[model samples]
Target: MEATYCAGVLSRGKLPVSNLRKSDHGFQRLTSQRKAIASVSCHLSNGLGESSCKSHGFHGGSYHGGAVGKGKDPILQTRCSAGVSMYGESFLESHSHATEDKIGVLLLNLGGPETLHDVQPFLFNLFADPDIIRLPRLFRFLQWPLAKLISVLRAPKSKEGYAAIGGGSPLRKITDEQAHALKMALEAKNMPVNIYVGMRYWYPFTEEAVQQIKRDKITRLVVLPLYPQFSISTTGSSIRVLQNIFREDACLSRLPVAIIQSWYQREGYVRSMADLIAKELERFPKPEEVMVFFSAHGVPVSYVEDAGDPYKDQMEECIYLIMQELKARGINNDHTLAYQSRVGPVQWLKPYTDEVLVELGQRGVKSLLAVPVSFVSEHIETLEEIDIEYKELALESGIKNWGRVPALNCTSSFITDLADAVIEALPSAKAMTNSEGTSEEMDNDPLRYLVKMFFGSVLAFILLLSPKMVLAFRNHLF
Candidate 1:
C-alpha cells in the first residue's frame, strides 16, 4: 500500500530534474529542464510505461497517505516503504514504522567550479551570500554588482587554481559517493533513508534539491552538511536557504525536519581523523619527530568578533577532541593547528597554514605530516594548495619529508557514524534543538555566556517573586 501510494505521487507530476552528468567545464545548463518522469514510470510500470500493472494496493480510489492533504484525492497520497528502494530509485520507502515515514537526508557542501568557466559564477554565488559578504541595509542594492565585479576579477586566479587541480573540483563526485555510502550505511541499520547532495554555489543548488524533495514527497528531512564544523558562511547559509524555501512551499513547511548543525566531535569522526594521522605517520622514519600539522579552512576574523560566529571556537575544540582520541590510542606527536584559504587581504583566523609551514621549515623541522582536519574530502585546498603549492613551498624552505593525511571520504567507520548521527538527530517530535547534540565546549562566546547568566538571574528573581509563573515561563525555554 505504501509503495503504491509513493508511485502514484511520483507519477502524478513530471519532476523537473537536473542531470548529474560530468561536463568539461561544469554542469550543463539546458534551457528546458529534463523530467525524471520516465524513471518513475519505469519504477511503477516495472519496465513498462503505463502498460505493466499490478494491484497497486491502493484502496478507496485514493492513496490515503501522508503526502495527500485531508479530504483530497486519496490517489494523490504519498507513502514509501523503508528498505524498499534506494533514493533516486523507483520505490521510495522508509524502514521506520512499516515504511510509513520517508526520510530524506540532504547532504550540503560548498561546491567548487567544475571548470574554468564555472569559476566566476561560483564566486558570484559565494560572495552573494549575505553571510559571506555583509552589507548594511542602505548598501544592500550593491551586492549583485559587487559580487559580479569581484567574480570577474577573481575568476583568473580561481580558474588557475581549478586548472591546477585537474581543471575542476571533484567535490561533486566525492559528495555523491558520500551520499551513497551514507544511504547504504543507514539501510544496513534498518533506517530507510534517501541521500541527496545539495551544493551551495553550483549545480544541484539548494533550490534544486528543495524541488526534488517536494517531488519525492519526503515526510521527514535531515539537513546534514558536509562541513563537520558549522560556520555562518557555510552551514548557516544552507540552513537559511532551506528555511526560506520551505516557508514558501506549503507541503514542505508542514514536513518534519531535523538538522544536524555540526558533528566534528563525534567519537567515530575523531577516531577516523586519528586513524588517518596514524597511517600517515608510518611514512616517516621517526614518527614522533614529525609535526601533526592541522590545516583548517579560514574565515575573516570579523565573522568571529562582530557577527558572533563560533566557528573558530568549535574548530579549536574539534582539534582538541581529535588529539584526545589520538592520545587514547597511545599515539603522541607534536601537533599544531593553522588556518588556510584566507582570501581578499582581510584578517582571518591564525596562525596561517602557509606561514606556519615556512616557520617550521626555518626551525629545521625536516619531517611533517600535514592534515586537512576540517576537510572531509579532497578538493582544491587539499589537492592543489596543500599538495602542489604548499609542497613546493615546503621543499624550497628545506623541509625534506612532507606528507598529508588522506581525507575521510567514505571511510567505513566514518560513514557508519554519519548514519548514526542522522538517526540520532531525528526527533520523535517536530523539532529538536542542536544544543542537545552538539558539545557544550563549542559554546564559548562571551555573548552566550552573558545571556545564560542574565537568564539565570531572571529565573531566580521570578522564582522568588512569583513561583506560579515558573511553569508558564518554562514553556518558552526552547
Candidate 2:
C-alpha cells in the first residue's frame, strides 16, 4: 500500500513553469507524449516550493510553516489574513463564559477512498492540493487538469492496493469511531463538546465540516489534528484550509477557535504508545531481544532541511519519549526508525523502511516487531504496506517471526488524553482574524514568489520536453 499509494495517487514530480502571471496559459495537450511526461513528472521533484516554503518557522525565525508567528502569539499556521483582529494580548480572557457556549472539536485527518470507484477522484483531490504536490505558479492553472490526468492514470494500481486491503480504505470507518470515542471520552470528563471528523482528501472534507459547524451554530471551536506530530503537509495543510474558509465567512471569521498544534509530547499519548509496543513485543519468544522497528511515513528531505519542517525532529523526540516510558517499565529493547511511503522525484527521509528490513534480516535478527509510530489508526499504509509487503520482505530476506503493533484507534488512554488537550487549549482559543499579525508569513515576499514561479515554469517546460525524461515517465505509469 505504501508503494502503491505513493507511486499511484501521490506519485508526483516537480517541474518549473514559464511566462507565469496569475493567468491561464494554454490548451496544449500532447497525447502522443502525455503518458511519458505525466508518469515521469509524477515522481520527479522539480523543487519548486523550496524558496516559497523557506524557513518554515525555524531557527531564530519567528514565523513557522503556515503558522502564526511564534512566541506570545504562537498558534496554528493560519492563513486567515483578512478582517479586523478581534483578539487581544491574551486570548484566554478574550471571551468569557466559554463553558456556556456550544463547543465543537474538529478532528482533522487524511481521508482515503472508501471504495475502488472512489480512487480516481480521491487521487485527484490529493494531487490538486498545492500543499501536497506543490506545483509551480506558472502551471498553477493546470492544477485541476494535472490532477485529473494523474488520478485517471494511477487509479488502476491504487484501486488494486485498496482491493487487496478489503476493496477500500478503512480510514473513514476508523476515524469515525475515533470521533465517537473522543466524544464519549470528553463527555466522561463532564466537558462534552461535539466531535467532528474532517478528512483532508476524501469524503467528509474539511469544507463540509465547516459548513456543518455553521449550520449547527457551534460557538467555541477547537481544531485537533489527528496527527500527533506537526507537519506542514498534514496539520498545516488542514489548518490552511480552515484559514481560507474562516477568512471568507463573517460568522466563522469571528468565531472563537483554539487549535492543538501537536500532542505527541503529551504524557497520555506517550504511555499509550509504550503500552501498545510492550504488548506487541510480548508476542515474540524473547521479548527483550526483539527488534523494535518503527516505520513512519516519509516526506521529502527538502521539507525538513530547507522548509524547516519539524516532522523529523518531533518524530525523533516522540520516539525518545516513548522509549523512556518503556525503559521506565523495564521493557528496554533494541529499536530503530525508518521512513516509508515516499513519493516524488526527490530524496525522502532516510533510511527507507524497505532497505532497513532487508538489512536487519541480513543481520540475523530472528524476531522483529514493527511499530507504526506516526499513525494512530489502521490504514492502508499499516494494513497493506507494513503488515503485508514489509512482512513478506522480512521473511524472504532472513527473519522468521514478525509482528506489528496495533494503532491506537480508540485506545482509552489516548482518547482521554486528547480530551484533556482540547480542554487545555480552550483558554487560548484564538479567532483567525487579520489583526493578530499571524498571516504575514503565509504570503512571504510577493516578488520572490513571482520570480520562483517564473523559474519554475522554465524548468517544468524543459523537463516535460526532454526525450530521456519522457521515456522514464512512460515506464513509471504506463
TM-score of each: 0.70, 0.77
lDDT of 2 by residue, 52-132 (tens): 111111122111122111112112233332111213334344334566788888888887877888887777767766666
Worst 10 residues of 1 by lDDT: 1-10
lDDT of each: 0.61, 0.66
Q: Residue 38's C-alpha lDDT in candidate 1? A: 12
Instruction: Tell me the alpha-carbon RMSD of every candidate.
Output: 19.9, 15.2
Output the number of the TM-score-best candidate: 2
lDDT of model 2, residue 50: 10
Ten consecutive residues with minimal summed lDDT in candidate 2? Answer: 35-44
